[model samples]
Target: MEFADRVILVTGASSGLGRHAARALALAGATVVLLGRHEKRLDGVYDDILAAGGAQPVIMPFDLAEADDPRFNALAATLAHQLGRLDGILHSAAQFIKLSKLEHQRLKHWEAAFATNLMAPFALTRACLPLLEGAEDAAVLFSAEEHGLNPGPYWGGFGLSQAALIALAELFAAEHQDNPNLRFNVLIPGPVSSPMRHRTHPGEVPENLPKPESLLPFYLTWLGPQSRGRSGEVIRPDLGYDPSRQD
Candidate 1:
């Protein structure tokens, strides 16, 4: 029970990395809040967590693509009443808008990207900010990908939103680093075998990439108190990415 009394919110927990992360966090003894659009799938994950003798998780069925201000306010109230405070939040919920040139992209596609890839996190993070402030120690972790360093044209919507998301992490980190109670950072999971990954690279054989479960150790490190002194750093799950190993 590493996080026995802690509460953590994981969005897009129906499947993919979010599902794995929810299970991993629950097994470590945190009260996991599973948020996703699919109520049935979310319920199944919650049931499995309880069946495994972990904490009875909370299921919050919400479509990140459709999240609005009222939804956030209501969610905040609900969490405030149920848990009182949130120890962590993982914006692992992302819509992998596929490769398309900027000129060929539709306005709706771009809107959807901002909604799922960017605005959802912005709204949820803002709404949860007050509840997070109530925590003795907390972390806000964003699921980011390699961007800015390797910019290219084909990544259109998702790529552009991710660039914005990464910047948002730093923006929040800069604003909140002065506070001793909270920390903010971006977590880049690299190339993992996920539905989103397949969508992004449909030609690749799935077995070649690391499974979602394999990434949990790094996720645990950030979500837990172990990474307390760290903020604003972009954590790469690849061990080969170690700064000490840089030649």
Candidate 2:
């Protein structure tokens, strides 16, 4: 197992990209900490991993939108006490209410979007910086969106928050460019068949979209030892990877 000795924290592990990636990482031998809002859903993922003979996973039912400095610090401390090291983080948690016109979006929507999509990663990563730095090698992967890079109407705060998430990742990389132990990067999973995609584009056929499992190779590449020293780049797997193979 490539990650047999690694401890990786995966946000949004209850569903979507986070769920799939956590499963794969665990199977690859990483001790996965599954963080999500729903304990039952997290348990589902936890069970799935263990049933497949993957490494045992920790279920953390946490609300990203409500995370603060104290909570984040406590989380870090707990990880340190229990796992003792953090080798990687997959920031796949996101908050997407619905696609609406700028005027139609509410203040709460903006708040929730920024909190879950941008601020949570910032706070969590900041709190865990020490643990990550202490490791011989560490990587932080942020889940981004293609629309975040090229924004359009109706995407609203969700889009804006994703754009800012990219900037956050870049800034993390720039700040740690000289640190040989750490790397930060963003991944944009484009047109994948996910619950979020189905919610946003109900009219589109799910069968036409590439399955979420197809993006696992890209995620694993960044989280595993292969992408050492690579940081600050926004990766769109659809660009270089062939989607037809998934068919």
lDDT against the true structure, per candidate, is: 0.86, 0.91
**Could you tell me the TM-score of candidate 2?**
0.96
Which stretches in model 1 have alpha-carbon errors above 4 Å? Answer: 239-247
RMSD of 1: 3.8
Candidate 1 local Cα displacement, residue 68, angstroms: 1.8
lDDT of 1 by residue, 1-247 (tens): 7778999999988888988899989999999999998899999999888888888899998888887899988998899999888999989888766687788888888898889878999999999999888898898899987853355788877788888999898999999988878888888888788888888877777776778878899889888889886888888777332322213
TM-score of each: 0.94, 0.96
Query: Least accurate stretch of 10 residues (summed lDDT) in model 2?
Result: 238-247
lDDT of 2 by residue, 1-247 (tens): 8999999999999998899999999999999999999999999999999999999999888898997899999999999999899999999999896998998999999999999999999999999999999999899999988878977799989889988999999999999999977999999988888898888778777777778889999989999899998988888886343445434
